[model samples]
Target: SLIVKAISRLGPVARTGGVRGPHGVRSEGAFLSPLLALLLLLLLNWLHPHPKALKCYKTDSEASNLTLEGCSPDKISCVLHFRIDKSTGARHRGLSNCWNLNDKCGIADCLYTPHSRIEDHGSCCCRTDGCNLMENLRLVTSPPTATTMPSKGGSSQGNRNSTSKSSSNDSGSEGGLFAKGGSDQAASVLLFSLAPVLAICVTVVLGFFLYTRHRERRKSRSESVGLASYPVDNHPFPVGHLSSHIRLKERLATGKFGCVYIGEDAETDQRVAVKVFPPQERGSWLVEQELYSLPEMSHPNILCFIGADQCGQGPDLRLWLVTEYHPLGSAHDYLAGHTVSWIQLLDLAESLSRGLAFLHESSSEKPAIAHRDIKSRNVLIRSDLSCCIADLGLAKKFFQGESIGDVHPQVGTRRYMSPEVLEGAMSFYKDSFLRVDVYSLGLVLWEMLTRCTDAYGAEGVPAYRLPFEAETGSSNPSLSQMQAAVVIERRRPEFPAECQSHQGLSYLRETICCCWDHVPEARLTAACVAERCKALRRLPVSVAAEEARRRQQEEQLADQQAPAVDLQLPQAAVINEASAAASAEELRPLREAEDAV
Candidate 1:
């Protein structure tokens, strides 16, 4: 305060009662406040400043002309990307373009200089307008690859900003401009007083950082091989790792999510199936990722998952779930092309049931998973005619005692929905939910049988048709139409009389009936179905009468268990969040919407 008054008096003074200066002009004391404000304005401008539009030179390789292009509204810098081939040492240059602030460029708001060098990619960015000219853009210390791809650039920016903040805070906090003597003395006393505390804090922070870095290094080394380390984060998996390794080929199939593309790993050259999901189906992609990440989820009967990733950004953002490729395509298409023998039918059924059983049956400490949508189209056939389950977008998991999450009860294909699901009387209990999948599995099994030439050869094996499509006489039956046919009339897929003559087909027909039974509680579990298929497979068409008799005995024992049984019939099991089951009358209004699923 004393220094301020002395300075104001020495410079020029103007108060309501102050004397005049030599020139007879009176200066007011209010001017001192304005002087202080001007200093604050300068300091503020140095600390926080808004960026302006930056212009860069866009080199047109084809036209051989240079045009000035302004940075996009979301971008804050101009970048020059560069790449080099390792074998030939050939340098490739990407045209200068607008870059985002959080991009791979580690420096901005300065002259163009190579700042971020990652792998083979190196780029420099300048926030200054017209600074990214064709002449100004030149490789200083770049490797070969470019585009300012994000890696260490964000951390570099943080370090730079932190340095600036420290300097600004140190200079602005002390009264260096107004009272240098007291400010210096006070700063020295405070520094001496807090030196021990500051030292201890710095030591603790440094030690924690080093320990974290060591743990990360060990974790990265352990997970360098497989996807065991990959988490179910919403963001893309190993952003740079997948892009560099997988080389995508032509599209294989298209579905509700996106398209399936055939890709090969660059390192192994092994073929992979890349199932892509659109931006709108991101939730489905995440669900599939979580399911795949479960412990011991991998099985020979189940599709082998490699990893999941994201495609481009903005409007082109697409999610990718990679798995082992099967060239023969889905069972629906395979059965349409060629008729299957009785042995082939057994193989497909056995593998399909085993896969489903693995999914529905919990392993290790993980919860059971129910694939709500089970159909021939979602089953892929290998070269050996063995099948594997795929497309788990609508799958749900059941924990032992924990509360279940919200599931869209009306989701899954209507053609495959069980009677309980069709009437919306199904509870959210673990066993009841598994029963729903079993019902759909029965429908799929019937469809596969209808295509087997040996089962109904006498009646001139019928054309490939869905479960109720033959009964309803329509490819896509409405919910009202299905309920009227399957629920009201209690009709199932008809098995030709000739099928009864084949011992194997006869047992399978019986199994199908048990699977799609009207009573959800009486439906056969996936494990039971798998066991039945295995036993039936032993008694082929030429098997002896004794073998057939033994198979029948095994089937009877499978149903009546001595220990814990597969079917746990819970009468009126209302397990969903304090809410009663939606009755058939309640779901009557949603017939159209349910048909769309």
Candidate 2:
């Protein structure tokens, strides 16, 4: 029970501020009352109908045998009577109300019968309440017939009378219906004839615009290529001949695309890492160069880009990207040999986060970039123990309103791939790509923590192991193996229990967990991780201790400056008189000394 009480004190306690029994149900009614009232209010609102105003009968022919009584808040004035077929007496009646006055067409002319094959179709709309009633609709249903003639001479007279009557009927029934139809036909013919020409013109203009844009882009690419292909003499560093000017000392590492060598620039006597890419890997070399050459790409946390040059031709061609040589080499190499202290671990995490944050930042000069392949190997540690991010071959730039280019699905290292990337369900947005980098960063952080000697405490540092080495037992696990372990099984690199015992490491563990959340959106941004790392580096434990000590000192000084009181005084009056006399005597001496002077 004591242990339980002690553990319970670690977390927050919610204050209900009400009565509670042994089972905590005595105040149930208090909790339920407000909830019940809210539900009742919602139910009452749902049951109430909208207020009725001007009511009208509405029906559509398509929805047969269905009639709706619609009421508008705005007083309805117009009623429309439409007859689709006069012979069959098939009709639909509707009330036009200004429920939405902005969408309403005011005049009756706006509601007209469309030209149909049936000649008896007509509409008579009027602006009066209930004007579309059945009684008012009897005006045009039946017309008087022509009278018959008695004899052969009378037949001609009857024919003339019938013709006059028909003409009058036609005038009453919508004037010049055939003439209006003829005009409509003429307009439609003109539109049809010109539509093809307009479409062709638009298509031609669009094609021309796209073609010109493509040509301009191609020309720019060609110009850039021409500039890049210029002789080594044109370059700032001017490695006249790669073999003659640069002495390759030792092969540091080999990657899928290239091999890195610790080389000395013969002319300047400067140590540099020369990344030599074969002819087949020239594309990656070019991409790296382009990224490095971008404006505002320079940062302390980012590996310095010196220069790049191509030597030889055909199969013998070798592309060389020279960068500043760090004596400490990669974080992976450093960690493999030596276990870092907690401070060194924090520094490594912070520096790495800063580099990633810098790369992911967007400005007017450059678009944000994602270091798709962020791992221990890609992070280089300087002599000062601070790290810089390198190997940007798989890096991608994201501009506003533009999608990230479709990369080969399996471009990044299998171990560092995020859940979304592993499942091939990644959204090609800037944030999604950045989040992938963050997930990899989390794995790298785990790697740093595992390599910290202090993390294991008295048990001593654990043997260096790559992420998920326990599960897969291989440093280079296959894609399927990683998917099974990381995605299907949902296994993360084991955080040592000893590390979690420490406050700083515990906070860092939480950060790592948040960064590598299976849900990509739930992961923290690189900038956020960087800020957390920076905060961690500030050493909250020490800061808090210092603050407490300062506060204690302040309280002590305040106590010392406070006037003492004699609780054992014979009387309150005597104490007050003594204090007064003491104050007066102190003041009198100062006054006398001033007077003497």
Candidate 3:
């Protein structure tokens, strides 16, 4: 306070030079020199504020609030540092975030009310314009590169120049009494004219700096959270053991579950594919396979899992499941790598149907497993262009002690969710349980048919529209707008013109449409739908020929390699055998009944 008062008192003297008291003319000049000396000393102290100069301070708890009212050009922005103490709980952490205004509060059109709650982090920016402006701010700026001030000598020299210029201008106007007002007016006009241009440049540069700082802060925050939160596993896997378990020789596929390495077991010399789940999410891993997925068994078309190293939560905690390694990889991956003929598509359709049919049959220990999530990405292809289902996290069993009537209510994939699921009516009815999976299967078939279609037709659909459409209305939106139209207004997907041209494709398209019908009752069961797909198209000529035939013809070409030997079917096959027989019996009675009808 004392320093502030001293600086203010000296400001006028520094700007305006005057002689000392006239009574003592001899000593008047001496008095003027002392007063000028005092004025210069005060000016230096005023320009360099202590709070801003202390940039090296680690924390900013003591800093005063920002004062924009009488701010000079030099002190345009005030910045303070803060560190979150981890001893504080999660709620406290949230509050610290609020205090920092990391939620983008207190900016643009903010109402002056104080926010007191963590949940209200963005309360100050609740006004529509403020939120929009904040987004604009994020888009515009790069960040500041430096936080430190210029050297003391350079700063002092700048201050001196500023002080000298101000004194010179003031003395010139006052000494030339006749031209004083006109000169002052001219100077004021010049300063005013240049101010806008300078302000614009500064604003642009500052905005850019602020934006960059925000981005960097966000990145740093994310990294810090990941480091602090993700507990270090003493056992990260090496490339070799993981590859061997999955039977991955080369990486055929990599996904959220883990990498699918094409591998061969050294002991059995048997080729296999390995799927190792990440170290995280290990607790519920077995439950996912035994209860949710694999309890219900297989078909030739379903990619089979052999042996599993269900080592729980250690160096081997990464749940490694092995399966037959298909040399051709997945259907979607193959399409990406190379184009497929219509014949190949037919083969894929037939194979996937066979797999789905096996899943839908009710003879397994558990009720039939529903591959609730079906998409082109989950379809794997064999060397002969046959496809099979993979990834059953979203699957559910509905038969055993619990009936489909008792199935838990939940939806599957977003894009492939059945109308019933979207409408939140899944599991309400016994029949609708498997119907959801059937609907997803239909969506997968449609996706295969229109693989070349852009996510939505060319109409520029905004992001907000797509989810809403899919979630609600039955009527389809325009083709161009479909992709962007999410939410309750998602439009129905259609068959391609090329699909319509093929006679074999008409039944396939019709079957898909029926399966995806808005009404659950209208959709075909997976078994019936699979049969329909098989009835429509024959196996491609290339794929139908026996392996021996290919071997003889392509003696020069590599013989069709043996199917992956690692597929251990003792558990799955044993179960599948009993189920297949039972399924045949159940269908036999129904078939006899139908024949009599």
Give the top-scoring candidate (lDDT).
1
How high a TM-score does candidate 3 get? 0.42
**Clashing pairs in model 2, backbone N/Cα/C closer than 3 A:** none
The weakest ten consecutive residues by lDDT in model 1 span 571-580
Expressed as tens digits, the lDDT of each residue in 387-415 for candidate 1 is 99999898998877777767767668878
Q: lDDT by residue for model 3 over 46-106, one digit each (tens)?
A: 4432222111111223433322122222221212222223366111101100111111122
TM-score for candidate 1, residues paired by index: 0.52
* TM-scores for the candidates: 0.52, 0.55, 0.42
Q: All candidates' lDDT scores?
A: 0.66, 0.65, 0.48
> Model 1: which residue pairs collide?
14-27, 14-28, 83-144, 83-145, 84-144, 120-145, 121-145
lDDT of 2 by residue, 1-597 (tens): 432332232232222234676887656444434334333333333443222444444545342333435544332323443445566766554333222111111232323333333344433333333443444543332332331111212254564564345434544332122112223223323333444454566556556766887999986774356324533322336543555578888999999889999989688877889999998886788788878878888889999887777778778888888888998989889888999877788889988998999999999988899889999999999989999999999888887878555576556999999888888988867888899999999999999988876566446787888888898989789989999998899989999875544456776888899989999889988877877776665553443333334334434444653243233233444544554454344335433532442
Count backbone clashes in candidate 3: 38
Q: Which wins on TM-score, candidate 2 or candidate 3?
A: 2
